[model samples]
Target chain A: MHNEKVDILLIEGNDYEAKLALHNLKKHNLTNNLLHLRDGEQAADYIFATGEYEGRDISNRPKVVLLDINLPKMNGMEILKKIKSDERTRTIPVVILTSSRENRDVAEGYALGANSYIVKPIEFGSFSETITSLGLYWAIMNQEAPYIPNNLWQSISEA
Target chain B: MKNILLMKFFSTAAVTPKRFHFSAQKSEFEISHIPFKDSGVSVVNSSGQLLVAKQEIDTIETKPVMRTLHNARKIAEDAIIKNCPDVICALDRKGRFLTINDACVLWGYSPEEIEGKFFTDFVVADDIEKTLKAACACISTGKRTSIDNRCAHKEGHSIPMLWSVSWSADDNLFYCSGRDASDIKSAEISLQESTQRYRSLFDYNPDAVYSLDLKGNFTSANAKVAELTGCPIDQILTMSFVPFVDPEYMSVAAESFRKAAAGEKISYDLVIIDISGNRRHLNISNMPMIVHGKFTGIYGVAKDISESEANKAELKKLNESLEMKIMERTSQLEQSIKEMEAFSYSVSHDLRAPLRIINGYTKLLSNEYEGKFDADGKEFMTAIIENTKYMSRLIDDLLNLSRLGREAINKTIVDMNLITQVVIHELKMEDNSIVADFKIQDLSPTVCDQRLIRQVWTNLISNAIKYSKKKGTPQIEIGSYEKGNQTVYYIKDNGAGFDMKFAAKLFGVFVRLHDRSEFDGTGVGLALVQRIISKHGGKVWANGKVDEGAVFYFSLPNS
Candidate 1:
């Protein structure tokens, strides 16, 4: 299941929020190659091919990573910092999708190289609309960066 | 001329007389014979005492002529001794008065009555020894000696006398003269009393009174100077003022002293260390001591002000510490505000998530399983969704209210008429069923935070519409008028007015006057309106009656 081409990675800690996001993405037909991680730690492991995903191909990165700010382990901000700092996955667009509309979190998310910061609304219609637009935009409309091999990246950095 | 002719005839005739007799009544002369030279003639009185023997007589009647010349000389001498103003007296060797002149009346004594009395009897008891000593010295040295003593008067008062006595060895008597010295004595006494008064004034003064010589050495100092310098008066006088002055204020002290010595009165403040090493702040005044039209020294009066100086320093320190404490408290308040904002943000996010999920699933349940649900179940589901939305609005209003506290007001001149019109237009658009006729008048422009003031108008206008919409023809009037330094705006409505008693509770958070079933409200609108107006330094109040009408008024300062 982990070997497949992951188009979108949803890293949400809450079960209900994750289910709702998945449902909305499925309704929009953007869940075909989507992978949902329950916590920041699992998402980090999958993204960097560490821990349980050590043997996995690190070159096969997701197109977009949807991050929630509040998480159980290795919270969303820490995960965002790790992903943006690593050369292997820095190019992947990390969109912050959280329930918090706090200015501090929004500013920090963008400062840490998040592609987009969106607040999840409470109403069903508005929430459904936001998740659907977010999924369609990141998965279908947004252009993904071209993948470069590790040797090429190393050479480029040295040069 | 007749006597000269007679004298020439007698000389030529060689006439002499051993005894002469002349009677003015008889006009005859009898002369007795005596030895006589051919070229000289002698005239004698009837007692045969020779009156003149060197000159030739003109006739044997020369006795009367001789007696007349002697009487004239004796009269002049007696006049002089009788009229002398001083007590000119002759005293015997035993200090007895042999004779005294009429000037003895100055001592209340007659010359005849005091003739035989001892001179010492008239001397004051206190001066007797001095008078005796002076007389003895005069007798021994035969020199004139002067003494000042009091003579006892017959009236019992002592008369101050200045006596000059001389011993005459030929008569073995003391010739003494005494003058009245009352005036001199009174002058000396007054001078002594004035000096005493000045000395007391100097010593008893509270301030340190001292005099410094031209070289800045202490010449004289009062007792207070001893106390202030923590040194004895004698020691202070032995030292100059330079050693007692604090080094920091030595130059100032020197300058003031120099100016004073130059005859300029100078006053200055300086610090001094006393003998005990205690620092004393002093305000000193220095003036030139002009004695007998000459600048003699510097007179100084110093007042200790150490206590007041210390208090001033303490007050300055307290002011600095108070300012520091205020800054500390202000930062603490800012920190708490930041923390509260964080908490509100967390509440906004965390509290709404479950509600969102509940509402989302409920809507999905209603839409997907519409056939299985009965009418009541559907209504219950609808209520859940409605209540969730209401709770969400309540949370949003609460956040907005809390956020108002920390929001920095950006103020500008806002037109009240325009904001009211916009709010009215927006309210009409939101609910077209609001057929309440609006009577908006020309409003004065005021300085306020534009965004917050707009929110105020929105809340007030919507409240008016909501409360008055049930009337047949709801009449709403909005107008503003100038009140003192403020522009007061009012919104009146014909609606379900609350009791006037609960008017004070209207702006309280979550304090609803009407039941929820009658008027649908979360009870936070008026509170938000109040908060916004208050933050702008404005006031919000309402006047209402039961079922008649309610009018809300707000005043903004016209700056």
Candidate 2:
């Protein structure tokens, strides 16, 4: 059903890290319906279809949001808070894909309703391997949240 | 003196020559007969040693003997009363004096004056009862009795005197004789006073005072000793000090006792288990007790030192804990340093990622423009490759320096000579252009972190080889010796030696003295060597002159 709808939302602040993630996800064919955002602020807007995305569809929430902790404007932890606290967006599982492996960050990320915590390492092929498996899981294996069709998404946005 | 009077009376009754003998001295004496109607009596010396010398028997003259007896009144009056040295007096039954002698004057009285007064007037009031008893005995038993009493002297002081008296039944009077005794009485009083003073000092002293016999059995102990030993005074005195001493210190206790018994003043510290079985430390001083110039016993004074000893031990414990806390804080600081170094190293190591990206994209550009670039562009490509490789080497060196800081020091005994040989062997395997003649001396063993020390040796030796390689036969000497309580290992090289002025900068990271074209190096070798050696509580220094030689010395403190 997601062939016509967005399936995964990739949020990354670092340009290079974003390039690597997007490149690897495309290799698994999971990038076809994916939307890439640079910061937590845009990721949250795209998810809830508010602010700059005022007329955007909200019902077609991505099955998962690939997140980064270090952001330019709004940080990942704060974005995770907005998504999980709202009834309409709370079920969209968020996967943190930051380079930081600090225990405090991992613990705080999960406690704020993040679905999974993954530390991003820059060691050669490790980054590619991590994002590929993550893309395969969320796009192909993981079931979407109630499968809201395009028309339903438009209605939810209009309301 | 009285016996001589008796002999005189007898000789007179015998109607012979009428001679008399007196024994006051070892000589003869005679008292000429001038008979009074009152008869004489016998006499006594204060020492009682006098005896009548001879008795001349004139038994054939019975009439003369009877006549002598009839004149016994004369014998009593003249012999005992008149000649006695003591205060002699005759008192009637009413206690009135009838006759007084010359000694009465010594009591500030005369015979005529005291004869009519009461005998009690001459006796001290404190001794009146005793003096009267002596007077009454003469009347009741008709026998002589003496009592020591003080007679009141006219000057208001009392003279202690001994009086001998008897009753004359026919005359109804008591005849008394007194001798002075003030000297002996005063002496006895002084003795009593001194004994009380000494006793008070023994009983009232605050510190424990104990007396023991020559056999070490407790003779007596004061209240303070009883309190110190946690026993009653009476009970403690009944026991020897041996039971109170801890068994471990028994030998020392015995030695102290021996020295004290030997008449030497000795003192020592011992643990005493008091009555409650609590161990107490006591400082005891002992000396021999002497009586009549003979060593009779031992006396000791002791004080409880348990509290002071405990305080000293507590101070020592506090000092140890203080040292341990300082050590803990120092190690915590060291841990932070290691963590900070690891952070920097990890960041540098991560730089390899973007470096990989740069390398990949550059290759991508080069492939996209294959054969499309001019010679100048090709030269630029080569320069990029050269710079990247140089950066890679620099990053590797940076990581190594930081790794030395992060690694835990795993110390093991290392043979420096063997380690040097192995490092040189490795250098040959890595770069055969490092052709060198090596001179290695026997090196002492050192306890060090083996892997880190291997890195130290590798860096120092390779620098020595790399620098001196221009020599036809490159010379490098590796040796270790002791200096200033540290093991100093040095590497000497016959190569491009910098001036002594530049020696200070030799170990700075990325500081190279020579031109890069002359010798290819990362300029981090000496800096890494210095870092590793310093982590092992050592320091590195170099001494060199232009073109002569260079010697790098590093010293490790013996742990």
Candidate 3:
């Protein structure tokens, strides 16, 4: 039931922009079963189903992960690295979308195995189009890995 | 007219031998032959009366006939003497006067009164020797000759006269006719006046006009031409005209002269030496003057051409500078195009990505974890959202700087202090947190793009407020003064100041002298200020030391 509840994970910081984007995504019908993580460390620990997310099912990896760059604690780049480095979540798709098209973020995103990098458009119409396309692509078209039983997946992870 | 003829005949008779033919009437003795010379005789009657005398019937030589002839001649001569306009006088063999016409009598004494006076006494002292010599020659040769002499007028001044003399063989008398030549003297005076008028025109004409022979000798020149050429007229007459020309222009001068002498009108420029030995440029036109189909000399007129040549040189330099300025403007336009491209890339790359992250994950948060997170967790997420929105604002300021750099200055009259006050008032309306002490001084008007100048004031005033936000009471002073011909304005702020060592990078885009944490700006405001001021033919500078308040100064063109 716990694994079924967390269908997707989203990490973001800037509260106003985060709220605006959240409103936009809710209209797209993609984030109905999604979970929100505020900082890099929380996002990393929860994905591995350790720390705050311990005792929860780790076998059910989310369909996708959305990340924002400006954060209160550990930033988006480190969160992306933690997910790609682990065997259990390495196959999970991570999409980085931010207000800053800062060179460091784009380069680090690619280096850390980010699946997609998108810059938020300023105009409302273009932002809507960008979110709708991202949702359709990752949720409907992309082929997610089948759920591995906890015994097999965790035993392989322990080894 | 008849009196003039009789006087002419009597004067001729006094000089010529007396000869007459007369006829006798009932009581009048008429000499048929009276030898005007002594070789003939006249006849008389038995009553001792005069009668016609003749050596033969055709020629007369009788004493009565000679007396009758002499009486008749005297009567005719008296009529001529009374009517002649010119003075007429006779001189004896000894150069003494024998008779005079009425004109001569009127001119001086009567014929009887001066009959024996020597002719030299009537002549002026200077003319006496010449008169005596002419008289002696006339008496000896008995030749009809004329001489000009100054004779004493009745008023005691000398009157010029021409006298003609001949010998009379009959009475052995020397006969003379003297005519006053005062009319000739008046003609001479008129001739002198015309010569002086011609000379004055030549001497005072502005253009130097002179005549030169084919040999390059200056044959004639006006007084001014002589002075301009630095040669006396007498000296120039013998010297070569080529000597006054600069050595470099001598060949050209010679060729021009040769062409002119060959009947070709030649015009050219020459550098010549003036009276003070200073070189002068003259435009000279030379042409050959011919009289009666014979080439006399070359006539030339010269005017100064130095100023015109200098003006041409100045115009050439100005054209060169204009071309250089056009080239510089074209290159600047090209550079701005490239910078605009870079700015577009910055918009797409640096600005949009943060906005995307903020929008995307913030959406994920509220949607996925709305009821799950605590209030503090939600608050932290909201702060991230606020900061990213501000980041977009910073990017816009950067784009504004790029745009400001590219636009051309649309110049108009602007009052800088007025603009500063408006910006200050706007800022005050937005944030009333800090007390701002504005010491605004009077500002002069200058020609500038008012809209661009508004941006300048907005940037500087906003920056002052932003930098001084933390201070308990912000004191900002806006003032302007004239330096040389330009109006310089400054915004002084009581705030955290920056080091002056980084002044070199003050106007560079996004170059912040202060830390972003210290001042809430993208560092594009001052750069925009500088760009707008620089476009107005002005410059901007910042003066600040650490911990001291900073002052930003900019200047605008006076006109």
Candidate 4:
């Protein structure tokens, strides 16, 4: 179960800025198995198997998780903390996409265990290119760590 | 004819009655005559009877010889009486008095008394012996002479007199005449006083006065002219007056001298260069003078006017510098006006573009997709539209405040109570939910711009309403009071107050004291209020306690 591979998990706000980014990822076929979670809490349940997270395997995780900071309910920073602190989900690849070009947000995103930080551009052409390159890098080229449960005894049997 | 001639001679001789003679041979031959007083001849016999006397024949009495003798005596007597001076006396061979005239008698003596007295008694004691010797010498040598001496008068007082002495040879007497000499003595005293007055005026005059000859040379000068030119009086005598003038003005000095020589009284302001080549201002007054109908040389007076000329030049320089400073200040004021106009255009054009986009899109979404979307989705779009509208109002107010700070304010006396009341009424009309309690104090008069102060009141009262919306009654009090030399105004609200820690940021643009959910405001209100107050040369600030109340205060200085 720890060796099983998963597809994409998308976390964003305002369908306008995030949908424009998703249109370009389809060119590289990185949009396959993509799921759009509207806020930080839905993204947390998809990764953590908590609250209404029934029939979800706690060990299987996606190859890439795209996050946006400006969101309703729990912000992306609190979700990043939950994902990095859990033993079984610590090895998932996470990328941040945000509308703000402020240096404060960039510094804060990387400090919270986000693997990559990308500023969403206003122009459709530039936004598409940034999203395509970032999606291809994390989904295909980068290697992810094996998920480990809280009890280490079950991890040796799965390997 | 010979007998008649002898007869004529005898008869003419007989007319002088003092002659008595018969022939040269015999006296007793019977010749007799009576003598007349005027005629000197007489003829008589031994008897005292008339014999060919001057009165015997008419023809003989008419003889010219007798007539000539009588005429000579009358002339001598008339001359003595007519031409005698005030003091005349006759002296004998021994210097004794022979006779005295009426003039001599009036000299404190009687004619009979002075005739028998000696002439030396009337002479002064100091010169009596000398006068006697001079008189005796003149009489013996047959020469006439004169002398000046004091003579004694009959009243015992002496008078200065001049005596002229001459001797009569036949009578062996000396004649003397004396004239008074007192007029010459008084004329000598007047000459000395004029000399003293001239010397006093020469030493005391302020100008350097001097007299020059026909050639422009110094004849005499006072001490100041020598001191001013740094030359001694002896040196000035040898040096010509031309060398003391500046070299460039030498011809000017010569022309002045030429005019003076032509009998013209002329004056000129001349720059005189001394031995050290330092220029001085000299006012020279030159005049040609004549003494006793003879043309004398020019007289000159020179005065220093250097300080007055320097003061005039300094005043002119100060006036020029003052004009330059006024021109510089006017240009700086014009430049600030241009910059303010540009800032207003940027606020209206550049800033409004983005806000219009945010507002227009949100409105389009609500109108077109309101029925299809859930309730939460519709509410989110409405909030965005309201926030953008608030931002546009904030921009308009801020630009107006910035313009007030840049432009010059026209300060005039205004009543604070009336201005504050108008502002409070206007704010209440805009939002009826805000209940206002105006406890306005009788504010004193102040010198300030009325328009800028009105902006101050509008901003402060509106902020009180925006923050106090949560209060049940929404109580607000606006009032003013006098403190020392300033009039302080306050708008107090019982609303959601801010933390004291962030009170420093209350007057900054976009510095919100309350969250957007708790109170709805752009946060630019207090900033605009502060700027408008500052333009009128006043100050603004706020004080508060969290959740209790807030008070905004501003002050104007006593003008």
Distance (Å) between predicted and true CA of B254, model 4? 12
Candidate 4 residue spans exceeding 4 A from truth: A1-159, B1-271, B276-336, B371-380, B406-413, B445-447, B468-475, B483-486, B492-524, B541-551, B557-559
Locate the minimum summed-lDDT window of 10 residues in model 2 chain B: B50-59
Q: Please give, as one word, the docking class of candidate 1.
A: acceptable
Q: List the candidates ranked by lDDT, beginning with the highest.
A: 1, 2, 3, 4
Using TM-score, rank the candidates from best to worst.
1, 2, 3, 4
Worst 10 residues of 1 chain B by lDDT: B23-32
Clashing pairs for predicted structure model 1, backbone only = none
On lDDT, who's better, 3 or 4?
Answer: 3
Per-residue lDDT tens digits for candidate 3, residues B1-559, read 4334444444555466454333333333322233455434444454556454334424544555555456556766667556767767666667777777667654476666666788777788899998778767876777887889888866798888877877776677777777778898789889999988877767777778888887878878877677677777888778877778899899998888888989999899999986688887889999888979999988888877768878889999999999999999999988989877676656855566557556557656765889988999888877776676667767778666666655777887777667877877787788776477788888887888888888888888888877776778888998889999888989899887778888889888778777666676777777788778877889999898776678999998787
DockQ of each: 0.49, 0.05, 0.11, 0.02
Candidate 4 lDDT, A1-159, residue by residue in tens: 122345677787667545555656776787766777887777787787766664578777788888877677888888988888776787787887764444556787778788888755433344556777777777778786776677884566568
Model 3 clash tally, residue pairs: 42
- Choose 2 or 3, whichever is better by DockQ: 3
> What does candidate 1's lDDT look like per residue over A14-72, in tens digits?
88878877888888788999988888788899998888888888878888899888887
Cα-based lDDT at residue A64, candidate 3: 82
Evaluated with DockQ, which candidate comes out highest? 1
Superposition TM-score, candidate 1 onto the true structure: 0.67
